[model samples]
Each structure stands twice: as C-alpha cells, then as structure tokens.
Target: MAGRWTLARGVIHERASALDWAMDSRPRSDSRARECAGLGDGLSPAELSNLTPRAQIAEEWERVRLPESDRKLRVLIVGGAGVAGRNTAASLSKFCPQLQLVIGARNKDKGVQTVSTLGGNSEFVHVDINDFTSLQAAMADSDLVVHAAGPYEYADTKVLEAAIESKTTYVDISDHEGYSRRAKSYMNKAIAAGVPAITNAGANPGVSNLMAATLIHDAQTENRGQPQKLRYNYFTSGSGGTGPGVLSTTFYLLADEAVTYHQGEEKKLKPYSDKRSVSFGEGIGERDVFLLNVPEVASARRVFGVPTIDARFGTAPFFWNWTLLAVMKLLPVEILKDRRIVQFLSKFAYPFIRAVDVISGEKAAIRVDLECSDGYNTSAIFSHQRLAEAAGTATAAFVLAVLEGSTKPGVWYPEEPEGIAVEAREKLLRRAAEGAMEFQITKSFCRRKEKQGMKLGWIN
Candidate 1:
C-alpha cells in the first residue's frame, strides 16, 4: 500500500501560491515518488531550482525532520479505522515522517490496512474505547492522542479521562455539543494532569471554527464593533465520500434538536428542519443548508460572545437530503437515540452512500459569516474537492500545533486562544487549506450565488 504521499488534489499544498493551487489535479507518477523519496537530506541550489513547485514544498516539509534524539514522538490515533482518523494519519505521514504513528483501533485488519499506506514508522495497536484498561495502556505509551472515534452523541469523557490519566496531549474530532460539554468538564483534570486537550477538531467544527475566529478577530481588532450575528454554513457532496463514521454521525444526529442562539437566547429546533440557501463561493455556488446540532454553535456563543449564532449544513445530490428528512419523519426517537441500531443502519446504508458519492463527487465547502454591530460584515470560505482530505488536513494542523507547544494544558474549543494561539492561526489555516480549491478570508460578501458559464455540448 506504500505510495506517493499526496493530498487529495495531488500536489499543491500549504501556503502554496494561488497559481500552484490552481494547477491541474492529475497526480504525480510512482517514478516521481521514488525520486522524491530517495532525495538527500538537503538539496543544492541547482537541484532545488530544477524541481517543480510541488516537489519543492514536499522537500521543505521533509526537511523539517525530527532529530534522532527526538524521534520518539509517538502519536496514538484512536479509531484509526474511521474515515477521519485514516485521513489524519495520511496527512501526518505526508507532512511529518519523522515521528512514530500508532493506530489504536479496535479493528485490527482495518487499522493494519491504514498503517500499510502510511509507509514506515507506523504500526497498529488494538484498543477498545469502552475497555478502560485497553484505552489507558495505549495512551500511556504515546505522547499524543487523537480521538477520532465519534458519533460523539454516543461518546463519553472516558477517553479524555484516560488521556488525562496518561498525561498525554489529546485532541478529538467530536462534533456533538453534549460530548463537547462533557469534555469541557474535564478541563481541570486535564490541566492538573498536564494534558493539553482540544475537542471539536474536525473540518467544520475544526477549520470552520478557526475561520469564524479569524473573521471576528480581524473585525474587532480594527474596531469594527462587537459581532452581532454569526452564521456557519457548510456543504458536502454525497456521503462526504468517507467511511461509516460520517454516515453514522448523520444518522445519530437525527435524535438531537438543533440548537441556535438569538440575541443571547438559546433555541432548540428540529434537526434538518430549517433550510437556508447559502453560497459557498465559486466552485460550489449556492446550496440549500439546514440547521443541525453542531458543537461550534455553542462554542461561538460561549467563547466569542457573539449575540446571535446558527450553524447549518447541506449535501448533494439533493435526493439524499430528502432521504434523511424522510428518515427523521418516519423513525422513532427511541430508535434514532439508540446507537446500536443507528450503527447497524449506517453500515447497511454505507454501500448506497458510496454509490451516491461516485455520482455527486466528494467536494465540500465551508463558509463562516460574521456581522458586526458597526455595519461591518466579513466571511471566510474554504472549499475542497474532497471532504475526507480536508478533514484530515484540519485535524493534522491542530495536532501539529499542539505538538509544537501552542496549547496550554486543558480541554478547549477551536475558537479559544488556549486551543489555538492567535499567533499560530495563519499557519494552521494554510496547512488545513492545503488542497482546497478555494480558501479566502474576504471583507466583501463572497456568499452571493456567483454564476459560471455553462459548457454546452457544442458550445465553444
């Protein structure tokens, strides 16, 4: 399974020039991979000059190698068999090859498959989150832990507690508000144990929160007045082209009520009930988004003091939306709430999900809109051609930041300064947006449905 270490779109990466990201999506060859892999520790000016922009960037990352003395930085990726965890492992392998990676998954065969693709310095370990001894032992050996085992509605702080007990730095892709609140309750314990932990570190909850933070941070820094309204709009094409975890998350979320904030008041509405048409900039255009119970909504209100906030998500091709709505309408609340049933259903539907993914493609868009009281408005839009890839980059960025000592010991949300320092924000954004087709932080409204010229069969 060893192959070229590539982002989804194949080459252009973090902080790449606009032209570089705009390059063709076709991937480099195996010969090219071998050439790059065999490169020496440092390249001469003449050799560097001969390489393409893509190679140069890859070389630059490779050059940031861990010393022999510092090579023991083991990262334990719990739930490594899941879509998000696997992608995060891929990103980590691509960007930082020096450290050891331990895939802590209950599925031995699946984890082994993930590890094989990660090249060297990677191995798999069996870990059941429900088994405290198994989870604790895995964390005890690793310096850092990434908890991507989700459908956080069914998740508890037991994993976080284990990480705290092991005194390991931790982060998770938990998108559920209840789980986030539960994880927050362990802040004191995490701090006391010297375990710097962050929750809600996925694509939307991860990168989207950082985007909102940037918009509000820039606004207030320039005296644009307090943010009055904040809206998070997200779109992902068919099944998000990932594993069962994502599909299961969608199914499990049907049980919860969507939470929105209005002028400091909290409101709970039916999930996937409220729909709004939002533009995701150029490539994605306008998508009909629905209200969902996302963690960032509560985090925005609690961390940023934004008076009003709401988070909405949309997916395509449009029929899937109807299918979810129908399920919510027909299924019993008790059934939706029971995770065992949901897990079974999610797996059962996963094949069809993958089929839709083939037709719809896996692109996704994220838009964070902020309106300030002083008549100021701004947004940050990030659109990637693949959801899992973007999620991986986002998760890996946070992991790198924590490893680099950017966070203090405690459980914190993405928007919080403790979880991500204001200074390191730009680097994280660039890293996360590595393969994105569109990544912009604009003062102007970029959410309007901007049209592109259609290419009719015979039209020039």
Candidate 2:
C-alpha cells in the first residue's frame, strides 16, 4: 500500500495502510516489526518487502538549509563585562575561531579587560543598553548580538529594538517571564528585518526547554501517546557563584506569582505555595522544588502542545528557599513588585547570600519530566559542577547554532523548532552537555521520593 510519513515533534507519523496494519499487528520486540516503524526507503512495496531488517530505510527529511555565503561573521555581546557575558565570550573564542567578537559594555575598563582575557580577534565597544543609539551603532558592524546584561525584570526592549533596527541576529539569557514575553512580541519586526532573535537562552530556560522537547520527542517516537504533563525542576548551590545580578533576578522572581498552563489554559499560583519533591537523578538526587515565574512554562506549553506545564526551582543550603517563602508571606504585593525596593532588599541580603555561596559552592542541575498516555513517562536530567560555566556553555551552543545558520529569521524560544533546527539540536545538545556530571534521558517507571515536604528541607 502507498503511504507517506511526516515528522512532527521529532517523531515519524505514518499514514494508515495495509502495510501499516500488518506492521502494527506484529510484536514490537521482533526485529522485522521494529524495522517497520523506521522510515521506509523510497522503493516499491515489492522491493521494500524483500529487504532485510538491517537494510530497512531511514527517512530523509528536509533541513532548514541556509544560502552559501563566505562573509566573515561578527558577534557583539552586550554586557560583555559581566560574568556570564565574559564566559560566553571565552567559549565563543575557544570554540568558534572563525567569528570576530565584540564586547559591548557601558564601562570601558571592564570591557577592555574582558576583551584582553578573550584575546584573538576580540575587541571592545562602549555601548549602553539603555542608549538605543549607542546600541544600534555598536550592532551596526556585527552580524549577531547576544544580550547578557540583564536582571530583565523591569527591562525595556531597547537592545532588542536596536538589534532589529540594525538587522542583526539576537539572543539573550533573559529568565524573567515579563521580559521574555516582551521580547517575544518583537517576532514580526525581527522577521521583517530578516534577523533571528532568541530569548530565555540560558541554562534553566534554555537547556530545560530543550530537555522537555527531547523527552516529548522520545515518547512520541516510542509510540507513546501525546504528552499530558510537563514539569521542570531546577536547583543551584548558592547563586552559582554569579554576581549580584542573579540575586536580583531571583528576588524579583520570588516576588511574582507563578504562571502555569493547565488544561490548555493559563493559571496563576501563589509563589512558593505548592511544593514538590523532584529527583535530579544521580549525584544531585532529590530536592524540594517550589513554583516560580519562569519563562519556559509558556514557551514549552505552546511549543509542545502539552495541556499542563509548570516550572519549579530550589536552591541549596535549603534555608534560602525558606527565606524566599518567608519573604513571599511577609512582604506586601506592592512592595514585592517595586523594582527599587527589591533591588535594595537584594543588596541588603547580598553579604549573607554571598557567604552562603562560599559555603555551598557552585553546583547546578535541571530535570524535565513528561507524562504521556498509557503511563508512559520519560525524563531528561542535566547537572554541572558550576552554574556559571554551564550557563556559559549553553549560551555558547546557541550562539554557534545561530552562526551556523540554524535559526530562521524570527523571535523564538530555544525549544521551538524554528529557533534551533533538528540538525543543529543534536550538535547544540552535545556541546551543552559537555562537562555535565550527569546527563541522561531515561524512562521513569516509578516516581522516586526521597523527601516529602518543606519540613525535610532542613536536613540537606
């Protein structure tokens, strides 16, 4: 019987036919039966039927191919003086020597220092994100821009607007929900300018989003039904040795209500109210995770079509989480929402937070679980010894993909197919997974519970 196969969510869907029926009727464990699930070769049924199991066809899919061009690519990193930005510059310099690198910073000394540290075809440009003219001028000479200078909670779209105006590709590690949504609103303008822009391209939102996509893909490929739920759990040991910007970001996140999508509709939950125990697999084991306003929830829900999606995060030296809970309970909504007050509070707590960082060291992990029909569940876990390095690596992987012409001219989240094509996904994953102490995708049969509630947080 004549039939066609289509690829969606990284799975092949075959049109029903007599051959399909025959293939389904056979036991999945049988080698010949397994071959039937594979993409069949472009041959007549008679020819296909005579082929051996080892000779079964692999489907040829269309790739998002880019035009052949030999122009030298240049990447300008906004906030290149910061820790994450410096790490991204270093990674790009080490991994992508073909590209010219520019560091955009408001501080000339810091920018020069970062450039000196990165060496080789790297230079510094004095440009402030708040100054659109300066940003646009800095971006004018570059092919792409990576925005790493952000708390992003109260950020405007100045840098993004500048990039669009300059017709330069853009990427940012923004984790704030509001800023991410705002950045996403520039999709049309980005496409019109023929520039690809990606937001939430950091570790949790970036790698976590990709993990969810991969799990869904794996489940569908195994004939598991559509995913019904997706849960993201993340953990970091004491601010991951990053500077005060992360602390400010976390404080702002704690102040906001968590947004989750349930039954294909949006729902708001009280921050730090509903908590769950999630296992980050070996090494990291189990930890308590609480609801947070992360960007991945909405992005994953829309991209994967999952009915229920939520993201939760926890920190090591567990009292930090309790402190956030306490702040959420004690602080007024207006106070929590005030950026100035939040910044002041974060600064006040910085000394203690930094001390915790000294004690906890920098370790981070992310777990993404997907539940589908027939009790089929799959998860992907990634852990690194240091959060800053992991974030840098993940961001660098995305930059490389853009430089390699993987993304289309549109604003997208990392998990979206248009943001990173299937051909580039594997390469990006490989690069990001480097130096991860634990990185694996597994079928979870039973939910493991090492601890139950907030009361247990004291022990770890």
Candidate 3:
C-alpha cells in the first residue's frame, strides 16, 4: 500500500513538472538519465557529499498526476500547546498532507513553537477560548475547529457558539463530566444550525463510545432476547504529553466522592461502591478497580441500549489504591476545595502518582473486559499515553477526509463504521510510528460457558 502511494506520488510529481521539461525541450535518451537523476553533475564537493538516495530518486522519474482531491480543510485546533493538540497537528500533517492545518493558542509564542515543531504545512494563530471575539477572529474562514484546551470544568459553551456561528464542524476533548451532559442540550440548536459537534473525542468518552457500540453490535447479532449484561474494567497507568494527566484526574476523583448512577432506576453510589479484581497483560498484572461516576458510561447508557453496564477504573499496586482510599476517608469535606490543599497535592502527590509504573515506561495502558450473554467473554488492552494525541490526530484526519470527500459530513463517531474506524486508526498509527509513540490495540476473546441469550436495541 505504501509503495503504491509512493508510486502515485512520483507520477503526480512528474506531471506537475512536465511543463518545465517541455519548456526546456532538451529531453533525449542521453539526457533522460541525467535529468532523472535531478542532481546537476556540476556540483561542488560539498553538494556531492550531501546528496541523498531520496534526492537521487526524485531526479529520475516523472511523478504521476491525479486530479487533486480538494480536502479544502482549514482546520483550526484550539489549545494547540497541549499534548493532544501537538499530536493531532502531527497526524494531520502526515495523513492529510493537503490540509491547511492551523494551530491556535492564547499564547502566540506557544502556538508558533507547536506548529514549527509538529511540521507539515501549519500556521499559528493567537486566540483565547474564553474570549469570543478572539475565537471568532481565529476561526474565520475555517471549516472545522477542534477544541482541545480545557479543564472544561471552567469553560463555557462560547466556543461552541462560535463554531455554530461560523458554520464549522466542532469537536472537543472535554473531561468535565458536567459539560458533556449539558452538551446534549445544544444538540438541537447545533443540528438546526447545520453543524456537527462532538463533546468528547479523547479516551473514556471517545474510545469508550466505540467500545460500547462495538459490544452492542455484537450483542445484537449474537443474542436473541434476554437482558444483556456488560461491565468495563478500565485502567490507564501512565502520563502523556497531553490531556488530563493521572494526577489531575486523581484530584477530580478525590473531590467527587459521592458517585451517583442508575440501577433498574437512577440512584447514587458511594464512590468505590463496586470494587473488583482486574488484570491486564504481562508487566501489568492484576489490579483492583472501583466504579467511578463518569459521563462517558452515562452517555453510553443513554446513547446505546446496553441495559446493564458498569464501568470500574483504578490505578494498580494494591498499596496505592488502599492509600488513596484512606486519604479519601480522612480528608475533610471542606478541605477538598482548598487552594493550598490542591497546590500541595500538585507539588507533592502528583510526582509520586505519575511514577507508579516507571518499570514499564508506558504513558498509559487501558484494558476493557466485557462479559456478554451466551458466555462470550473478552478483554482488550491498549497501551499508549499518546492515545490522547492519537484521538486528536485521528479526529483531525477524519475532518480532513470529510472535507476531501473521502467521507461524508454528518454527526459521527469512531464506531459509526468499521471501515472509517480502521482508516482513522491507520492514519493515527502511521503518524504515531513516525513519532515513536505507537498506539497498540490487542483483543482476545473466550467462549467459556454457553448460556442464555440477550436482547439488544438502540437507545437513541
């Protein structure tokens, strides 16, 4: 596939350069080899030594030409300084070469540095998420906007408003559980405004949605009519260059102790209500997990009709979880929000939290275990802290592909179609490989004991 792409590129290059060769009109078989070599023979000693194999190849063949697929993409990535933004930019540059990638940041210098380091044809713009005028100005003449800069706990929907106003597609990696739930309120307006918006494109929210969709699809096909049972034992044990780090989420978990959920009916859960033993691949052995109330699972419940679903997450090392539990029990209710307390945690607890698994050197490793009806049980583990960036990059690739007519414009997610998901994953993996940050996904399933069937239906 890569060789074919290279051959096609060569042909395009040749066609584009044909006009120059025609003007010269000095093409004879004798000059053919020399011209194809591209390196002028009269090079000085310094130039001759610097010549590379790739350069020599460029000199030989006339590149093939095809009608350019107008990926008329002017993608504006908000919060381009962070890890996700940087990864997204890198991926877009590689997979969507014809895209006009723009990275926007409140800090001009940071934006410039991000674009310069990430490479590809990229530009930098100074914009603030909080400031509407700034967002509007930066987003002008853009077809898509990916909002990656947020603790969205503090962000407003002004960015979404701007996107709707500009008639541009919008996607965000929002960690704030509140924002994601409320985002549905604007779906009608967004649809009416003729713009598609995604509230969470990062892990948990992004990948979780796909995982649920895939499971639901499988369940529907396998099961006939019974209650489907599903549970997720998810864990990520590494810090990456982007998105909310382990330490930050730890603070969030500590602060939000009272977790609410739906049973047969809606109810509240004491944080850690359902603790269970879980396991990942080698080096990442068995670990205890706890159910935390997150909007991703909630959205999955509402969006996909997987009647019984539970999501449990925890970092490994039995001692660590025990200590965290102890801290949560002892910490005073009021002190959870204390500035000094958070600062102290940032200074002291975060470093230790991030270093829990230095042996593996993984940015993160996530495992999702599913036990469906009819005794089909499976578990898949993915390791890569760079996945947050891959999510952003994959999103960018999709946006570019949509603009290029490789895909259609509509509200969509990774699991909407297997082909689309595979393409996006390929693009992301290619870019990740270039950066030495590969996103590895492995799946294993077992049909242990055959049992009763289950019924499945789309909730929304």
Candidate 3 has a TM-score of 0.70
Candidate 3 per-residue C-alpha lDDT over 305-379 given as tens digits, one digit per residue, 9 for 90 to 100: 556666677764556667667867787645655645655765576566556556424344455545555445433
Deviation from native of the Cα of residue 14 in model 1, angstroms:
25
Q: Using TM-score, rank the candidates from best to worst.
A: 1, 2, 3
Per-residue lDDT over 111-202 for candidate 1, one digit per residue giving the tens place of the 0 to 100 score: 99999999889999999999989989898779899998887787777788899998989999998888999999998888889889999998
Question: Which should have the higher lDDT, number 1 or number 2?
Answer: 1
lDDT of 3 at 13: 16
Model 3: how large is the Cα RMSD against the reference?
Answer: 14.2
Tell me each candidate's TM-score. Answer: 0.83, 0.81, 0.70
**Candidate 2: tens digits of C-alpha lDDT, residues 136-188:** 89998798899999888888989899999989899999988788889989999
Candidates in order have lDDT scores of: 0.79, 0.76, 0.54
- Backbone clash count for every predicted candidate, in the order shown: 0, 0, 12
Arrange candidates, best lDDT first. Answer: 1, 2, 3
Off by over 4 Å in 2: 1-71, 445-460
> Which candidate gets the maximum lDDT versus the true structure?
1
Q: Higher lDDT: candidate 2 or 3?
A: 2
Better of 1 and 3 by lDDT: 1
